[model samples]
Target chain A: LSINQVNEMEYEDFISTFGNVVEHCSLFAAAIWSQRPFHGVKQLHKTFCDFIDTLPKLGKEGILRSHPDLAGRIAERGLLTTESTKEQLAAELNTLTPEEKANLTRLNEAYKTKFGFPFVICARDNKKAAILSGLEARLENETEKEVIQGVEEVKKIAFYRLLDILQHEEAEKLIGGW
Target chain B: LSINQVNEMEYEDFISTFGNVVEHCSLFAAAIWSQRPFHGVKQLHKTFCDFIDTLPKLGKEGILRSHPDLAGRIAERGLLTTESTKEQLAAELNTLTPEEKANLTRLNEAYKTKFGFPFVICARDNKKAAILSGLEARLENETEKEVIQGVEEVKKIAFYRLLDILQHEEAEKLIGGW
Candidate 1:
């Protein structure tokens, strides 16, 4: 929906549409707007920052529940993706030099052991080489910090995607002016 | 590591430790210097943002590769300590009336179908009731736009997390001067 529509939405409707955006992004902060009719995007941005600052304090149970189970084929394959990449990653997985494959396997195991989850990176934008390099480098991070940093990295990639989706000048103006 | 240690490290080392951060959160912009050290927190912050603003435009594939997976369980569960209410979302999810659960389920499916992914909200500091209410509202967003907004929310959350991890300022100087 257009920003104009968003602005004009009934309090309930606007909140609903906006909330879905927040939910899909895993943004708990923006979804919980204490007051409606946000003064403007600047106010909204400030509120957004204040909310994100508190995520690290969540205990282990909270963090675990926050993660989705990577079950079934997805568990084996690592993640779901477009058909092309699925084929590409599969092919690359096959062709890895025995050494490269071993390193990847080692990196993968180290990453999971350190972080308590798969070493997930947004492979969409990266080539196989860059992905491997990133995987190797991140394996060195102490688990606590890596977990925090990895989540943030995921958030950044998600934002770029959001900008792509929203062509609304008003939304841009909201962010730009803010 | 302490902010002091971060400051003491060579430029390349600093980048290595925090490069992923700059890569994902700082807009993919980099400023390479043959022989200049980041002298202080203010200088570092400015350089970081400058580089971020200069990030090369990413292609669709590149953009897609940038985002990490959403914290689904976190969105559905977790305690939003940042909010005054200190809300527990999992409990709220459990308490969802049958109708609410159905709507959420439908919304989740619709959101994923349209966006090619599940709805992601950065629920670091929100109350559970607020999130559920938001999920109910946002499900109505057009598929494309909702995804866009979700990514943006994710970016803002990531930026905040970056600052937390890279504490460039000396606490005494930061607070005392402020």
Candidate 2:
């Protein structure tokens, strides 16, 4: 979304869209969206705790669906920095590997059998190996706790990505001395 | 260090040691250590903003070195849990990597080539690949910046590890709740 569009968003609307980001992968999206208003990367970090404080609690199913599967060509893709549909297609279709394809299949089966939902992980700058590792390790966790932890991890990921996209030079300059 | 040793540290000693951790990493280590004798993790997290407020300037070199390379085996290896060793290690090896057999060769070479000090990272629950990745990444940074960033990274790693060791039950409880 453009800064102009973001500027037009009412506080409530801003909260809603950004909240969806957080609710999806509380750790990843929250980390990215947590830094708003075009500040440089430096001051961008200061806002994280504030964002954390305002975070809404996510439910198990909501958290489960937040992350996409790592199979296909998705693992090689980076975080989505724009609203273009083409970017999404390019990322997903070009990066899948044979191992990731097979692993994702097994993960789908296990996740469906255990929790009736697909496994989720906020996937920005994450490889298929990392995703598979996370998925396998999380399987050992109680469904309830894993859901919560997954949300936290997602938010963290979001907060970081948000900084990369939102922070501007002026913001960085203003906060640089701090 | 044991609770008893930590309990014995004067405020000055505490601050100095904590500052070293902050000097090492500017994120959670600085945030958590900025507040002392926190009643609980909740309090520590709650006052995260206040802690950030107390952060010193992030100089160029210092900021770059904030993240240390994680050592897979060294991270898994345990530290002496008493306060005496904690203080001594804190003073003497302000930035030392955890020992690992596989890393000894490279770690030695890297230290000799880059700086006069051994590589350091906060090695909690990290594996060899993760730590190696950190080392390789930091090696790309300029010497001055790498040291600063490395110290900060080490601080973050240590702070989390310290919290884990100190309030073992509480950390577990918090992890479960998350």
Candidate 3:
């Protein structure tokens, strides 16, 4: 839908479309739905980020903890959220070799043990090798630093999700209707 | 974990464990993390219900909308949240024959068209027949009445989910640490 369409969208429609832009943190979208008539997508993204930025450390960590691990149990069970499954597949996380999967499993656990939250990166923006190395690198950061980094990664994921919606909206416009 | 243990558990652990009790609304759990030291499971349940009760109309609808539809596209894609998947399967929604699926799909769409949010029942507590008839019956209600009923159904879902967690905690306690 266009920005004008979004501005005029009903509350329920606005949420169902963009609520998941911030992963499972639809509360971010719900809280800011009142700030309608967003000039464009960028301001909409900023509203979500600013709401997220206001949360305390524990709240931010909760957001990180909401993310499933890369090649983790949820993926193994084929039950990742639609957004997560797409992002993971985009990173070729599903194509990892047995050894790579095992390594990722190990590092994901270690990262959680170290920071008490799952390691989160924008899987759509990183390949398996980058994801593996990034996990190893992030495992060393302090919890506070990791929370900030993880939240930043969530925002990156959100940005891509928003863009995906925009592209689909454009395609829908061309196709006339669903 | 016991309420005692839960009372002392870290915020991240608390969320990761109980966050999905309200379907995908982890924000409910996150919003109440500070109100720790709940006397027991009932108290915790009340806390959640109270938090939910406080939400305004749109907010309540958002919670209802966050839930995936019964036997809907998300279930067909096998991407329903883990909690929802189990609940739907328990209701035997996954076992519907082609004709049954078609009937349910038609009714579900009719219900959604009549009321903005999907028809939500505590699927774990109701069989497919009940669900189908329930959908047919509820379609005639006013939207405001449906919203209240839907939110009440959500609370029932959350109640069962909490009890499942409590039972698991009991079993875990009996088995000792992993």
Candidate 4:
């Protein structure tokens, strides 16, 4: 939808449209619902991010942990959200060789054993090899370092997801002033 | 550290050691510090993840947004945290060909334009080709789908990072009961 159209949306309508952008955490949309009539997609995006930034540490970690593991049990049981399924597919994670799957499983277990949560990466932005190597390599970091890294990755994911919601060809043209 | 050592650590020592694991957000360590005398590494990891899960959404997103972009301006300025710098290097994002760099620049801009933040992937988990292709393909996703996908990736990054912190040989043996 056009930025102008978004700006005109009622609060509930706005939430309904943009609330799901950050996974099941519609609270982001709910929190920012009253700040409607965003100047454009940029403002809208900024508002959501800013709101998230303002949350306490515990809340932020919850959102970070809310995501599923890459090709972990959630994916195996076909329990991932639709978007996750597609993103994993794009990375070709669904077609792993047995060795690759075993490796991933090992990495996932190792990663979880250390970090207390599943390993997360934008699978669509990586091939399985990269993901596997990343899993193996990051296993050597300190806990403090890893937690920070995890959150940063989550933000990037959120940012891209927000863009997907806001940017269409026409909206991109308008936002880019094309 | 061994689960036994972790279990014996004073509250201050525990936070001091593990506090920075989640970036500037030390609350994870702080909140869980009192729940000390962890039975083992598995229990320790569980405590941390469980604490994170208990947080409200806003707090969770804050943690998610705390991370720096992979190979974005922060890295260009040489201001990424030590771990991030190493992780990006491991992925070889710092050594892009000029053409590849330009492509990355273009993709980054397009991605940020479409999304509100920089694209995030676990660089250490991907090759340049995978990163580039992942960036290129994800641009076609709808906003909600992308947001979910992005957060999922961030989670993977965090999971690996956590593993890095918790998975020392001793702890692994303890957790694995080997």
lDDT of 2 by residue, B14-116 (tens): 4334433332322333224323566665554444434433333222222322222222222335433333234324433334455443564476357536743
Docking model 4 quality class:
incorrect
- Residue pair clashes in candidate 3: none
Ranking under lDDT, best-scoring first?
A: 3, 4, 2, 1
Query: TM-score of chain B, per candidate?
Result: 0.47, 0.44, 0.91, 0.75
Model 2 Cα displacement at A169 (Å)?
3.7
Task: Provide the lowest-lDDT 10-residue window in model 4 chain A.
Answer: A169-178
Q: Write the per-residue lDDT of candidate 1 for residues A20-52, one digit (tens) a residue.
A: 222122223223333334444444444443444
lDDT of 2 by residue, A1-87 (tens): 545565455332444444334333222222333234633343433454344434333223433443444442233455433421232
lDDT tens per residue, model 4, B74-148? 789998776678778888997889899889889977876675445667676788889999989988887556655
Provide i-RMS per model in Å.
14.4, 16.0, 4.8, 10.5
lDDT of 4: 0.66
Candidates' chain A TM-scores = 0.54, 0.54, 0.92, 0.83
For each prediction in turn, the share of the native Cα contacts (below 8 Å between chains A and B) that it retains comes to: 0.00, 0.00, 0.18, 0.00
Model 4 misplacement above 4 A:
A170-178, B1-178
Tell me how each candidate scores on DockQ against the true complex: 0.02, 0.01, 0.14, 0.02
Backbone clash tally (model 1): 27
What is the DockQ score, from 0 to 1, of model 4?
0.02
Top-scoring candidate (lDDT): 3
